[model samples]
Target: MSPFLINLALNFLFGSKGKEVIDLAQRLILAAENAGGSGEEKFRAVMTALSQYAQEHGLLANFPQPLREAIFRLVIEALVFLLSKQGLINTHKRAYYEQPTFPWA
Candidate 1:
């Protein structure tokens, strides 16, 4: 997971684009919190919100479908790590808390 995340960060978040992705992540955290649900639900909400925002803003637009999904998954993992670290949510031991079915493209 760490390697995949590091790779994603390097691939998608270089130069000025890094700041934009960070800002998007911060907004995503707030959105998930406001979603007001159990840990899994809030986490799923983050991915859903991310998908919608990405589609609207053409984020990762040029990437292939598989690569785009991988990037989105890493983004969700990063967000979940943040949420868990801040004590805002707790995930089950299962890998990625059984990743929600969101539109990744």
Candidate 2:
């Protein structure tokens, strides 16, 4: 299973109030895959979805900074894992190292 799917499953199984977020991420992942973009583009799409979810749901504001950071980290890691599984990323590199360079960058 891709990391995104795994995280979604685990969140559904163990995370309290994570169903919506997981479902959103899953949908975004599927969309990115179907869009047939480059690996980097697909990864960016997933990250963008996650960022949008966090902002829309006020996850960043509702949770403490540490908790918010942790959650974001988990989601990014899951995305990288999923992308890598799809042969989009080189698994040898650290996922955290590949930061997106947007205006938010």
Candidate 3:
């Protein structure tokens, strides 16, 4: 998904309290970079944060089923794009597009 859609999903997830989530996401991205993980790893780390936020907020229950599914998909797509841009994923080939093998996933 495009970054615009990702931003929209994030906004919806955070509601009017999105600042914390955005700050946390930024910090996590920086931490991932500092840890020297590949872009893919960093992206996965961000995804972990998203998952954690969802669980913590019980976001799924707060939304209708269809909206929840859409947000989930957007989050996943945003992560893929983030990883690809960071060169963590093998964008030159189609290899890393497989299901996330990360421990958290």
- Any runs in candidate 3 off by more than 4 Å, and if so which? 1-15, 61-73, 76-105
Cα error, residue 18 of model 2, in Å, equals: 4.7
lDDT of 2 by residue, 1-95 (tens): 66687668767776865766558757776757766768778766766776677788776776786786677668777666656656666656544
Which of the two candidates, 1 or 3, achieves a greater TM-score against the reference? 1
| Candidate 2 runs further than 4 Å off | 1-18, 62-73, 79-105
TM-score of each: 0.51, 0.46, 0.39
Q: Each candidate: what lDDT?
A: 0.71, 0.67, 0.64
| Ordered list by lDDT, greatest first | 1, 2, 3
Highest-scoring model, lDDT: 1
What lDDT does candidate 1 reach at residue 58?
A: 83
Best by TM-score: 1
> Which ten residues in a row are the worst by lDDT in model 1?
92-101
Give per-residue CA lDDT, model 3, range 62-82, as digits (tens).
Answer: 787568657865866665566
As for model 1, its CA RMSD to the true structure in angstroms is 8.4
